[model samples]
Target chain A: GQQVMQIPQYQHVQEGEDFTTYCNSSTTLSNIQWYKQRPGGHPVFLIQLVKSGEVKKQKRLTFQFGEAKKNSSLHITATQTTDVGTYFCVSSHQAGTALIFGKGTTLSVSS
Target chain B: GAGVSQSPSNKVTEKGKDVELRCDPISGHTALYWYRQSLGQGLEFLIYFQGNSAPDKSGLPSDRFSAERTGGSVSTLTIQRTQQEDSAVYLCASSPPANEQYFGPGTRLTVT
Candidate 1:
């Protein structure tokens, strides 16, 4: 069974601070996707990376995939109160059969 | 152009009872998935269905859990003889052509 492990299970930061969460897998992944779940809300699709060593930016959020395609990271700079939620990194099997979700990093921002 | 939708936003049942949750994936989407999220936990994959392919139920925790997709549109997840540990938010998601995944609001099930 393949498992995606995320670091810093929980993160709390002051407004305007930075936050980052890392994800790793024991086996290589064909691609990886990121999702965000607001408090008491359903998970929403954020972004996806398919190429090796790919880097993408969406506003203040930055996503990177490892060259080996076994790890990924999400970094948020100058976080805002609206950034309070859990970020999850998910990967699918080589055949795209099942999706493996990471435990997620819950981020809390206080103004 | 609507997103996925789930029925019975919340449900309460007693132990040893049976419960069914429904999911309506976006129109024309061929890939549907079922996931469970316990309190303060991440999404746990339960099952998957592709266009006309046999479902993959490898993530099912026990024989008590079962799901079905009819006509390749709607899906229903049934849990028989539910236990208190079964209380959790059952989420449904669908991806078009098997790529990015979009999730539904989810059904919050509580077993007493």
Candidate 2:
């Protein structure tokens, strides 16, 4: 069975601090996707990394896929109150199949 | 276009009662999925539908849980004789092949 594990199950930081969550998979993944779920909101797609050693950035957020394609990381800089939510990493052998999700890292920022 | 829509935003039911949750996916999407998220827990894959292929039900917890996608658009998940432990949020998502999934606001089911 395939499994994705995310570290730092919970993190709380000052409003101006940076945050990072790591994800590791037991099996090689075709691609890794990142999502954010605001409090009481549905998960929303943030970004996806398909190539090994790929890196993509969205404003203050940066996503990276390991060269082996089995791991990934999401980093956020200068967190804001609006960034308070659960960050999840999901992967599948290929798309159009059920995605295996990592135990998300819940981020809490306090101003 | 609608992202995704789910009915009965919240549900409260007594134990042993049967319940059904519905999900309407974005039009033109051929893949649909169901997932469960318990309080303070991660998302659990339940099932997946791709185009006309048979759905993958290996993630279903038990025979008590079943789901079907009608016309490749709307989906329904049914739980027979639900138990208190069945309380959780049911989420539905749809995506194009090899693309990111778009989720619907989940239905919260509370089994008393």
Candidate 2 lDDT over A1-111, as tens digits, reads 266999999999999999999999867898999999988888899998999999999999999999999899999999999999999999997655667778899999999
Candidate 2's residue-wise lDDT over B1-112, tens digit each?
Answer: 6689998899999999999999999999888889999998889989989999999998899999999998888999999999999999999999998689999999999999
Off by over 4 Å in 2: none
lDDT of 1 by residue, B46-89 (tens): 99999999998999999999999999999999999999999999
Candidate 1 backbone collisions, by pair: none
**Per-model lDDT:** 0.93, 0.92
Q: Which runs in model 1 stand beyond 4 Å of their true positions?
A: none
TM-score of each: 0.97, 0.97
Which is the leading candidate under TM-score? 1
Go through the candidates in order and give each one's DockQ: 0.76, 0.77
Residue A89 of candidate 1: its Cα lDDT? 94
